[model samples]
Target: MHRHFQGLALLAVAAALAILAPVFCAERPAAAGAAPSPDSQSAAPVVIQVDAAHPTGPYSPAWNYFGADEPNYVYSKNGEKLLRELAALSPAPVHVRLHNLLTTGDGAASLKWGSTNAYREDADGNPVYDWTITDRIFDAMLDAGVQPLVEVGFMPEALSTHPEPYRHDFPKGDIFTGWSYPPKDYAKWAALVTAWATHLRDRYGVESLNGWLWEVWNEPDINYWHGTPEEYDRLYDVTAQAIRSVLPNALIGGPDSTGPGTGRAAEFLEQFLEHCLRGKNSATGGTGAPLNFISFHPKGSPTEVDGHVRMGIQRQLAAMDRGMKIVASFPEYKHTPIILGESDPEGCGACSVATNPSDVYRNGPLYGVSVAEAEARTYELARKNGVVLKGSVTWALEFEDQPYFAGFRDLATNGVDKPVLNVFRMLGMLTGEWLPTTSSGGLPLDDILNSGVTRAPDVNAIATRSEHEVDVFVWNYHDDDVQVPPANVHLNVDGLRQGRVRVEQFRMDSDHSNSYRAWLDMGSPAAPTPEQQAQLERAGKLETLGTPQNLKIAGGRLPLTFDLPRQGVELVRISWR
Candidate 1:
């Protein structure tokens, strides 16, 4: 439960690092808040090619997973608007994970906490389960074309074994308070779960609710859970058994531990898996519990280094690597879908830049760039470890009525989408079969995962070719917060019909699709007028770099060119006839 100590840095040193070619030649600083370019340029650029004809793997949509700490916020004005935006981003249903669904409260939400008032008791202390608030939360998701990852957690006041201090007040800086305690009665806890599952099935229909994911709790390997390991194990067993009693086809899995790269947390996950596979069920007296999937939390540790915020992408990747390795060790779960319960740039999405300078990245384009890198690496990791990655939840969403650019790790501020959200929109545009891609300027996956883009910056791209179109996403990412020169990329298309091609480019940069920069440019107005708000909303959307163009390729091979600024992402789509 300790949060102070830094995890052990596990880097893959044996992986080779490829020196990317300086294709764009000139080292010019990137415009729109990107890194400043070098003084001059060099030659002998590496030529990265995309072979669209050869398919590699399935283009699983991992970008659709999003979440937040406050479950009640899903029904808020901004929360509803943001959910619609997320829903429109992808064709698939957006899966959102939230905490404090069953905690006792008046349906209030805040940074690092939330409550639904799903359980309570009378003066005589009779069990009372209320699904009113919980139903509204799920209703909002379903109405917005989204579904809940369905995190059932945080012991309610009436059910908590240690209910002396039930409610956690984060405004008063109370964390992991009495709500983190275990339940007083196991049968009652299981009954609560059964009622929850039955209510969901009856309300949403069994077929619809069956597709939803149910996780036991938040990060139990950390301070979020106060119970002993065995106690938590028994809790999980009862929770699972109870949920299944109502909806037998329900998909559920958990133990959502902290970063597995951390020594103690890694050991905790291993032991938990061993408990599920080998250890006997504390409640049912069986060999194991029903584990349909596996889940864990991994967070990046960003800090101000050398007067700049350098993101710990390596730390997050190491945790994923270790987590997959641990799961792979168990032959039973090797094929289980692994869900990254919560993935983000750092911990405490509510912590503001006023409190921590390192979080300043949230209000800018770096957040978007980091997301692009994270998406590519996650798929790469799953392939390397031979695992099925069902989803990876981005645990920060909108904080309603928050000041503009407050520096909270959210996709939007006060209803205006951030640059990072645009990245997800770009990812949503890419679907269908996966095309093999190579980038001369892109760093090796191992290098980016282990050391980040600190060495020379990674100008990378991934291509997806569908039946009639090819989409290539490119980015210029660097760990350090400094803005560097934009890298001009020359994308070579290897296999395409020699005919008319229509190309479009969507970009996320300081000036193009970033509302934060627009807000700053407007003198950081605390209260923007109607016109200004309209302008900000427009800027927050996915913007195109230039007018759409048509190309006539003589042969089946074509060459495309574009400039990607540091901490910027560009999606180039080409449709051919």
Candidate 2:
């Protein structure tokens, strides 16, 4: 550590970080439901090296998969604004997914719930398809240069076995009684799906629809599905056939089981794949279903301990590790694309800080850094498992008209961007092959999932090199909210063409690109004044940490050092003349 960093300025920064410790580490009453406090420590400086010339693989734009529960929210004022902002993040195709596209009701968006009355049958039992609301949802995405990862949906009223008890009011009531039931008639269900696909293909063009992935349903192995294992297999068979009838060679896969932990979800994931591989098709009476890709959900577990948030990032990563291992072990599906349909810090996106105190991190930089940590682990697991980790859809998007920093796992609260949203902006800026990177303080992937970063912060970074740019992303992450010492990073970048360079640093932390902080300073306004609103709007965007700096690289090596606060993420971009 002395060899990597030894300077008075560094010591001063370290001391200042110590002085500001209580801001992040102070204890609050358990009932106050505040964000967890990280244990205070004298952070050791981490030495990381980025080998730009040794490109490993393309930094696949797999991070663009975004979703939410409310389908109609796509066209809402806040939703439209957020969607367009998301589209602008990456040139790589952004695939949007949503729920309740086929449920029965007037289009109304709510927490943990949404509905679009897309299908109905008349008194004569004749099928009637209303593409109105669903089309609007699709149109909003398409118009913004975004596409869909079509989540072909919850049972519609006309076809559900028990449609009367719809509109789940979970965490508040038990109306989720019927939406989980299987279709009353398999034939009607198949026809409804066929018509839905045909409409999308016709309206959006077959070529465009072909580019999108058509997943059979959301998580069918949990409360999301009230059917038995064999019954879900049957549903998948018919749904796949129905979709393929219109969209030729349609991409489909599922079971979308909850994380492959040692329980019912894990068992269901294994059994579902077996059924897809060997069981007779319930629709065609042929062995195997048309499975192009496999999907599942892996969510983190955050528990309130001593009135602080101790995130279960390891639990989520372990689940993904086991899940990928299961898929890779199967010789036939070893190389198939894997989409973890719902990847989040935890389940229950609708549960806010209002009820769940552990979620207090949603308002600050913790959400951003946690996502960065998970993404790094996700890629590591993919390489270890040897499968095409296609996309891990972020299960939360925007909730329009909510109070500022409402503490849902959302990209934004009530239209203003959250710190988590800018993390993607930092990721979107990288476009090249991944450079070999090693960090002294980074935790090993296996060790992280097995235990978590309890003893020290996982100070890590990822490097990418393009023809004209070298991008480095760093984050300070730990499972517990204890305020660890600032990760003073001394990044030694190698393999650069020795010459003059320009370096720009962007940040997402309490004081930058974080509207939640700005809102809190303004008295946690339920409704901000016009000037406050304007202030938050500007605060919501991705902002630079400081002015760009000029430097020179001699003999293809350069070293840059910066301090990263707890739960903060930083990206340094270098370009040469």
Candidate 3:
């Protein structure tokens, strides 16, 4: 086995051990509230019906849901180490995206190449292409069992109409330099993609390359693309044709604009879709476009209000709903897979500077809970819209060699798993099949909407079951703030045959695989002592809450009750013989 695979296996073992350790063995305060007695009248089970009849997808595992963006900083030694470390956690497949690969030039004028920064100009102004940097990045992901949600973006410098002032004017101390601008030439852009696609087919084989989803530019409606919608359409046409020229079976598609149903994004998506269906390609003069998938970017807000973090979950969901509706309007796009590319709590992946206000949430549980909540909601929206939502690419991953707590939006800090990653680990265990379930007395849908439940709504539950196993994931989270009132939950599971079902539970809260508080205990990672390091080692653990219990089934119902803290997530798996 490859060394990375071996390393990943070891990390998995460690995580499993941490999750299976005796709950009482860990040093911690007794849970503030007691587990409700089964016979207690007030603790009566809130019976939720499980519809075993209505099922979707063969309960087989859906894609492993995760998010990633290009980490230009990973070019440094420390950044590479951090990426490898994060790769070990949840070795399940991840969706990796290239945010600024099409950027070129320098200072206030550099441009990125999106998926691969392949085109560079020599001193003689000739186009020079390099794949070594991206090859290493993709290799690392492949070794980790990750899949690339290939984002074909920013016009390569040699292809951009405006190429000289290529890069963004990033503030001082910003590590993301030279990777965020439009390409320099269009023909060169097509050639670069064609070459890159052929290279992937050569290096990883055509079969492997076929599985990757090719997305066009990122947030063309926003700062990512300065071109007008018509120009972007032309760019898309040429790029799609180019990609197909090499890999005819390549899954190519994207408008990748920001929030396709609102503001400028909605306008951009509508125009792109219309053009794909009706607008004649100047080159081909045909209505049929190579649109295999539809993609758009949706981001939540990360504003600090009233001394607590506020996430814009509603805004994102609304965007998703609109995007889906727009796609469904066209018969041609009805079956095309929709991707929520670059879905996150906020925009600005490289906003680590002090001037960028959104960087505040990057280092704590705020980011973790926000990511979990946002993803879960995205899934819900997709089901509601009845659209085939394929991937919600998290615009975050490890930045290779930044400081221990450099404030970059990442899944880990200095090789430690963040709370956000714990959610993915929990998700990885739930791949096989989705079962039917019902919840008694959840916050009404309208109540959730009217009250802006994105802040602090109500208890939410989702369940999935297989032949012998049933998994129930429950959460007690509110939208706007972290300080939530304690709530008691009575989970009543029906439809289980009378038998002992072994139960395993995993949880995320103020503790357990949480690096935010660990950083705090370590004095903010600014100054670290030996003891602090030890504390960090202990703190970055996913603690087992309790031992797996073999519960007796009675009267075709099983009852379990526990007090869930605010912003907490719980996973329960019950398997019967």
The per-prediction tally of clashing pairs is 11, 7, 48
Task: Give lDDT tens digits, candidate 3, residues 255-355.
Answer: 87787646667888888999988897844668757788888876655455544455666666666778888888788777888877667666655555334
lDDT of 1 by residue, 215-290 (tens): 8988887767888888888888889888888878788898889879879899889989988988899778989888
Sequence-dependent TM-score of model 3: 0.82
Worst 10 residues of 1 by lDDT: 15-24
lDDT of each: 0.78, 0.79, 0.60
What's the TM for model 1? 0.92
State every prediction's TM-score relative to the real structure. Answer: 0.92, 0.92, 0.82
Please give, for residues 410-469, the per-residue lDDT of candidate 2 as tens digits: 888777888899999998887888888887767777667677665567778887888899
Sorted by TM-score, highest first, which candidate order results? 1, 2, 3
Model 1 C-alpha lDDT versus the unseen true structure: 0.78
Considering summed lDDT, which 10 consecutive residues are worst modelled in model 2? 1-10
Q: CA shift at 505, candidate 2, in angstroms? A: 0.8
Is 1 or 3 the stronger prediction by TM-score?
A: 1
Error of 2 at 199 (Å): 1.1
